[model samples]
Target: MDGQWVEVADRVLVRRHAELDLSAGLVVGDGGCLVVDTRGDERQGAELAAEVRRITRAPWTVVITHSHFDHSFGTRSFLECPVWAHEDCRADLAENGAAARDTWARWYRERGDDGIADDIAATEIVLPDRLVTGVAELSVGGRRVVLSHFGPGHSGNDLVVHVPDAGVVFAGDLVENGAPPDYEDAHPLGWPPALDGLLGLLGPGDGTVVPGHGDPVDRGFVVAQRAEIAAVAELCREVAAGRMGLEEAVQLSPYPRETTVTALGRPLDGPPPAPGGREIMRARSWGCPG
Candidate 1:
C-alpha cells in the first residue's frame, strides 16, 4: 500500500507514502469528511485531493498536525475549506515557512533529488484558518472528532485529531513509528508528558494510533515509546543539573546520539521562564506528573 488508502477502522483511512514514509489520513463521515496533513507539495497535494475525491465527494475539512513543510505545504491544493491547527502552527508557518522550504530544498538538491527540491522551492505555504488554542470539537458530517493540543513535543504547536468512535488518534509527530522522534524543533522535557496526554486519550478498547509518519500503531507501542521518551527527558534533566555530562546523557538516551544531542540543546517550549526558571509550569499546564 505504497500510495493507497488503508482502512484502519470502518471509515477512517490512512494513505502511506514512500516519499518520507509519510502517512496522511482521511475520515469519512455520513455527510462530510476530514483530511489530515495534506502531502508535501502542490502536485502531491493535488494527487491526494484527487484521491480524497475518489473516496469522498462529501465536503472535507483539513487539519494539519504541525507546521513542518511536508505536513503543511501541500495545503494550497485543499483551499477554500476551513483548515485547523494549533495557534502556534500559524505563527510558525508565517515566520519560518520560507526558511524551511529553502533549507529542505537545498538539502534535497544536494542529494541529487532535484525534482523534489524543485517542487519544494515552488510550493506556496498555506496557513490554517481555524486555530485550536487547547481543545476544539468538530463535527465531520454527523461524526464527532476532537482536536487537542497536548503540549509541545515534536514542535512548538502539535495538534492531534481524535476520532472518538473509531478509537484512532492522528498523533502528528508526537509519536513516530519508523524512525526516532524528531528533536530539531522539539521540547525534550515536555515530549514525554505530551505522549502521556496522548495515551490518556486512548480508551481500553481503543488501539489504533496513527503517527505523523510510518504505519499505524497500537497502545502497547505508544506506551513503550512513551517510556523511551521519558528516559530521554530524565537524561535531559540529569545533564541540566550537572549530574550527567552531555555525552553521557546522549549515551544513555533511548534514541540516537544525534537525536539526543539535538533534544538536549533545545529550551523547554514556552514563553521565557520566570526569574527562578519555572520548568514545572509547562508540566502543570499539561497536567503532567511532577
Candidate 2:
C-alpha cells in the first residue's frame, strides 16, 4: 500500500500520496463503489487500484476531477470501467495529455527522476468516456454520488464529487489545503464563484472536504480559502484595470510570490479556454511538481 487511507466519513476514504501529496478517494457502497481521481501514472494508478481492492472487491467507477496529469494520467489502470469527468476534460486530455506527458517527462528527466519520466513517457492517455457538462448523479450500490461542474475555476474542466450520504465533498484542485491555489491553468476571475458553488454542496452541515492535495479539510477551511482566492481575483481585476500594479498584487497576495505572479499573468476576464482552443502546459515551478 502507498499509504494508509484515512476514513474521512462512513464508507468514504482518502488515500494520500507522498509524491505530490495527492489525494485519491474511495466511497464504498452496498452494491458498487466510486473512485475519485486516479494517481499520477499507470504504476501509481496500479498501486491505488490495489489499495482499492484491499478495501472492497466491488466494481468501481472513476471520476476525474480535472485533466491535470497528477489527477488524470493514471486513469488507464482503472479502465474497463466507466470513467467520468467534465465534458471539457475529455477534450483537454485528447488535446494536451500527450504534450503534458512529454513535457513532464522531460522535466523529471532533467531532475534525474528518469523512472517517473519514463513512466510518464509510457503512459497511454485514456479519455473519459462518460462526460458531465453541468451536473450528474451516480448510484453507487445504494448510496448517491453527485458530480457537478460549476463553471471554470482551477481549470477549464474542474469536477466536484459530492457524497451526500456521508457529507463528504471531493473538491479536487478547486480548493487547496497545504499550498496556494495553482494558477498555471486557473481562471482567476471565475475561481471564487466556482468555490461558491462548491460551498453550496456543504449546505449548512459540517462536511469533510478531500482536496486534490494535502489533508482533508472542514467547511471553514474552504471558506477561508475562498476568500483568499476572491482576494486574488480582485487583485487580478485591479491589475487589469490599472488600479493596482502587478508587483503590488504579488506583494498583497495571500499566496506565495511565484503563485501570485502566475495568477496575475492569466486572463482576468472571461472563462478559461475551451479544449483545442488554447492549452497551457503544466509548468515545473507551479503546483504538483512532477
Judging by lDDT against the true structure, name the best candidate: 2
**Tens digit per residue, CA lDDT, model 1, 226-265:** 9998898888788778899998887788887767876777
lDDT of 2 by residue, 1-290 (tens): 23888888999999988777789999999979999999879998999999999999999999999998889989989879999999999988888788778877877788788999899889889999999999999999899999999988988899999999899999999988777788878898889999999999999877999899888999999999999999999999899899999888888999888788878888875444433222223233234343
lDDT of each: 0.83, 0.86
Candidate 2 deviation (Cα RMSD): 2.7
TM-score leader: 2
lDDT of 1 at 83: 99
Candidate 2 segments whose C-alpha is farther than 4 A from its true place: 270-290
Question: Over all chains combined, what TM-score does candidate 1 have?
Answer: 0.91
Clashes per candidate, residues 3 or more apart or on different chains = 0, 0
